[model samples]
Target: MKRFLAFVKKEFFHILRDRRTLLILFGMPLAMVLLFGFALTNEIKNAKIAVLDLDHGPHSRQITDRLLSSGYFQLIQNLNASRDIEPAFRRGKVKLVVVFPPNFSQDFARNDTEAQVQLLADASEQNTAISLTNYATNIIQNYKSEQAPPGTVAPMQIDVQPRMVFNPELRGAFVFVPGVMAMVLLLVSALMTSVTIAREKEMGTMEVLMVSPLSQLQILFGKVLPYLLLSFINGCVIIALGVFLLGIPLNGSLLLLLAETLLFTFLSLSLGLLISTIADTQLVAMFASLLVLLMPTIFLSGFIFPIESMPRFLQFVSNIIPAKYFIEIVKGIMIKGIGLDLLWKPTLLLLGMSAFLMAVSLRNLKPRLNQ
Candidate 1:
């Protein structure tokens, strides 16, 4: 037990002594959280819009005021004619053009049945245009509601009230933060462990450790323990940034979240160890870790895309990516506040993968020692 503790301590010293490793261990999570939370978000803010108010009436001006006050849009141009609308969009000054028909205020005041406005959006950026249209529609609808006399029901009106659960405001950070956590934990744990072990091989120190009294399991555990601890810390840092900085809610049990994080870290570390055992050099191990672990985690894990929306074959391929399960586990725990009852399947899958990888890594490591 003392020898095992000493081995763990040696690993810690090795990590602490290297400034670059320490920076990557601690700094990368913060940088990624800030980058994803602030820069890489889908939420539209200050989107430029053009208004072509033909009516030049109170109701049209009121609608424009509502849009500007809502903070989603910035009025960049006022078009007098239809010809100017294309020019505004061509100049890239506006993402959308709102055209109020002639006699818009009088039509609404007379309660005309067919009062309407037209929204022309730049289809070049499809998602942004869609979001802008939705925002404008919501603002216009609210304006209409406000203008309507109290207790007056419109014929064929269907009231649709949307309640956004978890992230009510639909902040993109809420979507990306959990994914960043999964990707960061997996990449950092796997990359660091694989590179560390491969570096030992490159430096010819692995044979010295093999000659020592430490068993193969002890040596493997020693290498994994430091990274496991570090990865857990990294996970905590990410969760903290999400909650405090990005306002992501952690509605489930904190202990459960941490336990699940530790499980995923173990899974990543085992996979890294397996890579280290197979690859002969640090470069090979690093590339193998990036290509094998990082890309799949980012693309197939439902990190940035929906796995269900993917084709059947790609969905089946995603099953092998451990981050997919971990991301679901995280969103379940953090966003939905669901307990183990809802998350048992993914938890079991992660556990099984961790055990399988650890077993394979130990098997591979044992044969190498004999050689």
Candidate 2:
């Protein structure tokens, strides 16, 4: 009994002495609980939408006003023409557009025919578009019902026709496949690279390489090159599986998609190298990668959960995650068939992140010349 107690005590001491492990052990549970409880929700909030109020009637204006007041949507633009709706969607500025045809109030008052309101949604993000359309339709219906006289049928009738652009049929796989690609590539590339580099440090080969003729950048590139190729291959496999097994369409340019995948892989590799520099051991590196990369990639990247619904602070935190941008790029290309014109922002963000991580990793990598 005494021997067993001594062994347990030694283990406790070792755990307490390793601050990184101790921190991760305690912090991971807290983060998971907080993220699941708060950030990971299916609800939509502050979704950007545009209003094209061609009617300009009192009833039309009232309906528009109510929509803006609802917490679920933010009115980014009040469009003047029908022509502007497609442009707004293409710019990725708005998910749904509410168009009130002229003589909306007059038609509603007559009750001879139903007054029509068109709800046009950019269905590239099919789930969000569906949610927004449903919410808007419900609100408009409620308003129409309220205008009725007591015990009398309401003369005003509003018919909402929801049109889902890009993806006419809302397929769950369409939304998730791209997200899965991002998460899988990130995990396989970042976690694997970090663990491999940390293994070299633990085994003492890193010092030998440091003293060799190869410069730090060259050594880092050499270490990363194999993983880069492997990650690219993995990406291709995942894309193929999504297309063949899942029946998700690859609508956009295949060459562009491959190029973007390579860029994202580079970002993940740089992040892994950065993690390796921060952690002294393979276990520590693995834990760091899981905590910083995996959790955020899955939860905060709009993978399984919507980022807009998360708390404001969490939304801000998500902006720094590389997977968030990459997922956006993938979805735009695959689902919307959008070109570089619509995708430049997220593409640039990934590029900037790759450069930042590489610079920081190089700075932190102080390979011992003589150990």
> How do the predictions measure up, each by TM-score?
0.60, 0.93
Please tell me which predicted candidate would have the highest TM-score against the true structure. 2
Whole-model lDDT values for every prediction: 0.78, 0.87
Over 159-268, each residue of candidate 1 has an lDDT whose tens digit, in order, gives 22332334546677767777889888988899999999889888889889998999878987898899999999999999999889988888898999999999999999
Q: Over the stretch 194-241, how does candidate 2's per-residue lDDT look in tens digits?
A: 998899989888888887999877887898899899999989998998
Off by over 4 Å in 1: 1-159
> What TM-score should be assigned to candidate 2?
0.93
